[model samples]
Target: MKISAFGHAWVLRWRWMLAVLAIAALPAGLSAWQWQRGEDKAATLARIARWASEGAVGLDGLGARTDAAQIDGMVLDFEARWIAPMVWLVDNRVVDRRPGYDVVIAVEDIGAARVAGSRNAPARAALVNLGWIAA
Candidate 1:
C-alpha cells in the first residue's frame, strides 16, 4: 500500500510542523498579551483623568485603606508637609523629548490622624510623585 503525498509528508514531517507551529504561536500569544496590557493602561489613564477633573479629595475622605487593589488607580489629594531631605528621583522618565527622572518625596500628611480615624495613631510618611524633571 502506498501513502498519498500529503499523508507521506505528514507522517515524516509531523515533528517539524509541530515545532514550527509552536514557534509561530509564541510570538502571536506574546503580542496579544502586550496589546491587552496597553489597552489596560489606556483605560487606567482615562479613568485617572476623569477622576482628576472632578477635583481632589482629601486622604482622610478615603480613610486609612492601604490595599493597592482599592487605590491603584485613584487620584488623591491631601495636605502634607514635604520631607525634602528624603527626596528621590526615579530614572528613565521622558518629557517633551527630554530624558529625566520623576521626583518623589516623602510627605507627612497633617490630617493623618483623621485618616486613621484616631488621634493616637502616629502620622506616617508617604511617598508622593512630583512629576518629571530634566536629568
Candidate 2:
C-alpha cells in the first residue's frame, strides 16, 4: 500500500487527539464525581448537625415512620427497660484519655403502646449504646 505523508500525519494526529482527550476526560470525570461525593457528604453532615441541634424527642413523637434515613441521627427519649442477660461489651474504646469498653444492651420501650407501627402491640427491643465502662 502506498501511503501519503498527509494521510499518515492525519492518522497520527487523530490517535494523539484521542489519547489526549481520554487523558483529559478521565481526570475531569473523576474530579466531577469526587466533587459530587463531597457535596453529598457535606449535605449529610449538615443534616446530622441539624438533627443534633433540634435536641432529643420522645419516641412516640416519631409517628409511624420506619425509614432508616428518617430515623438516623435522631435523638429520642422514651421509657425503656433494659432486657436482662443480653449485654455486649465493645472493647478497645477510648474515652477522655482512658481506655474502656462501650456497654451495649437491648432495651424495650414500655411507654409506647405501638412501636414501629407493628400490628401486634409487643414491646420491641432496640440496642442502646451506653457509656464507656472502665476496662
Q: In terms of TM-score, how similar is model 2 to the real structure?
A: 0.56
lDDT of 1 by residue, 53-100 (tens): 877776665677787655665777777888768989899988899999
Q: Kindly list the per-residue Cα lDDT of model 2 for residues 4-108, writing each as its tens digit.
A: 685563334667778999999999999999999999889878988987888888766678868877777678888888899889999999988889998989998
Determine the backbone clash count of candidate 2: 0
Give the Cα lDDT of each candidate.
0.80, 0.80
Worst 10 residues of 2 by lDDT: 1-10
Q: How does model 1 fare in lDDT? A: 0.80
Worst 10 residues of 1 by lDDT: 1-10
Clashing pairs in 2: none
